[model samples]
Structures are given as structure tokens and as C-alpha cells.
Target: MQFETCHIPGLVIVTPKVFSDSRGFFFEAYNRKPFEEAGITANFVQDNQSQSSYGVIRGLHFQRNPFAQSKLVRVLQGTILDVGVDIREGSPTFGQHFSIELSAENKKQLFLPAGFAHGFSVLSETAIVAYKCDNYYSKESEGGIRYDDPELAIDWKIDPAKAIVSGKDLELPLLSESFANFTY
Candidate 1:
């Protein structure tokens, strides 16, 4: 596997070396030793999966300290534009964001360390997204920034009129309002 760090410290992009033949293909999606050698040492504790159709957007989400999570995310069935934002206060890149195309064809994965916010936009007719997390979910600690915040200016690659979002996501605060207690 190959790992490349993003602009944010601790955030990474993982590309697996796939072995393909006329029959099919195989690759080590996760190997502890290689990951550790690549400088990723998070102890994944839970796995989660979700399916969404094109135009669906979910994210800019994170948990507060004591329940913050580090996530390794990938696509299983279709494609999506995965995004991660640096919400860690005091960091040089705070408020900055990174995005990548993840698809079953590419077999690429993204590591979003704690202190970051994550979300994605489904680009295919349907998409199955999977992820591993170092911490469990905590409802009380859940937080997020509005997906359309002008300060962040994320291009979700989908028309705003066609975008579908949950009521919870719609209720999220803007970046300025949400960063009051942020810390690295």
C-alpha cells in the first residue's frame, strides 16, 4: 500500500497496490505493519457503512474531545467526492479542506485523523461508503459545520438545487459559529 499525507498533519491518502488478472483482482486494503510503517497507528474500534444516491451529501461532521474519531474511509460500490476539513485550532491549516475522488475502480482510501471534520457527496447513481473509526459514536459530542458555509467554499461537484441533505445537517452551524471551542 502507498500512503501520502495531505496538507493537514496526520491526514492521509492510501492507495493499494492491486494485483489484477483476467479473473479478478486483489489487494491488501489494510495491513497493520505496513500502515504503521507509513506512520498511521490509529487503533480502529468500529466499522461503519452507508449507501447514498447521486446528489446526496452528508458531512462536515465531527465529535468533540473525549469522543473524537479518526476515520479510514473508502468506496465500495460506486463513487463519491470525499472531503475532510482541518478544524484543529492553532494548526497552520485550520479551516482548510481537502477532497478526493474515491471509487470501487480506484480502490483508494482516505485517513481523516481526529481533529478534522468529514463528509462526502455521492457522484454515482448509487454509492456504498465504508469506513473504520478509532472511536465509537457519541451523540452528545456530535458537531458539524454547515456544508454551504461561504468561508469554507467547498465545491461538492453537484448542483445545489439537486443536493439532498438531512435535517440534522441543515441545522449545523456555520464555520465561524462552530469553531468557538476548537483546539488542536
Candidate 2:
């Protein structure tokens, strides 16, 4: 596997070296030793999966303080435009985001360290997204930035009219308001 650091200090993109044949393919999605050697040693405690249809948008979300989570995410069935935003206050890239295409075909994964917000837009008829998190979910700590917050200006690659969002996501605060207590 090859790991590339993003603009943020601890965020990374991982590309697994796949071995393919006429029959199929294989790759080590996760190897603790190499990941630890690469400086990602988060002790994952939970695994989650979700499926969404095209035009569905799911974030710009994170957990606050003691419940913040670091995640390793990938696509299992289709494609998605995944995004991670640096919410860590005082960081040079705070409020900035990294976007990438993740698909079953590419077999690529993204590493979002704690102190960031994550979200994705499904690009296929249906997409299966899976992720490993260093911390368990905490409802009380859940927080998010509005997906269409002008200050952030994220291009979700879909028409606003066609985009589908949850009521919670639609009610999220803007980046400025959400960052009041953020720390790097």
C-alpha cells in the first residue's frame, strides 16, 4: 500500500497495490504494522457501513472533543465523491477540504484523522460505503457543518435541486458557527 499525505497534517490517502489475474484480484486493505510504521496508529474500535443512492449527500459531519473519531473509509460496491474538511482550529488549512473519487474499481481508501469533518455524495445508482473508526459513535457529540455553507463552497458534483439530504444535515450550522470550540 502507498500512503500520501493530504494538505492537513494527519490526513492521508491510501492506494493499495492490487494483484489481479483473469480470475480476480486481491489486496491488503489493512495491515496494522505498515500502517503503524506510516504514522497512523489509531486503535479502531468500530466499523460502520452505509448504502446510498445517486444524488444522496451525507455530510460535513464530525463528533466534538472527547468523541472525535479518526476513520479509514472506502467504497465497496459503486462510486462516490468523498470529502474531508479540516475543522481543527489554528491549523493552516482549517476550513479547507480534500475531495477524491472512491470506487470499487479503484480500491482506494482515505484516512481522515480526528479533528476533521467528513461527507460524501453518491455517484452511482447505489453505493456501499464502509469505514473503520477509532472511536465509537456518540449521539450527543455529533455535529456538522451545512453541506452548502457558502464559506466552504464545496462542489458536490451534483445539481442542488437533485441533491438529497437528511433533515439533520439540512439544519447543520455554517463552518464559522461550528468552529467556535474547535481545536487543532
Candidate that would win on lDDT? 1
Candidate 1 local Cα displacement, residue 87, angstroms? 0.4
For each candidate, the alpha-carbon lDDT, in order, equals 0.93, 0.92
Model 2, 36-138: lDDT tens digits are 9899999999999999999999998999878889999999999999999999888899999889999999999999988889999999999999999999999
Worst 10 residues of 1 by lDDT: 175-184
The residue pairs found clashing in candidate 2 are none
| Cα lDDT tens digits for candidate 1, 7-44 | 77878999999999999999988888999898889999
lDDT of 2: 0.92
The lowest-lDDT stretch of 10 consecutive residues in candidate 2 is 175-184
Give model 2's TM-score versus the native structure.
0.97
Residue pairs whose backbone atoms clash in candidate 1: none
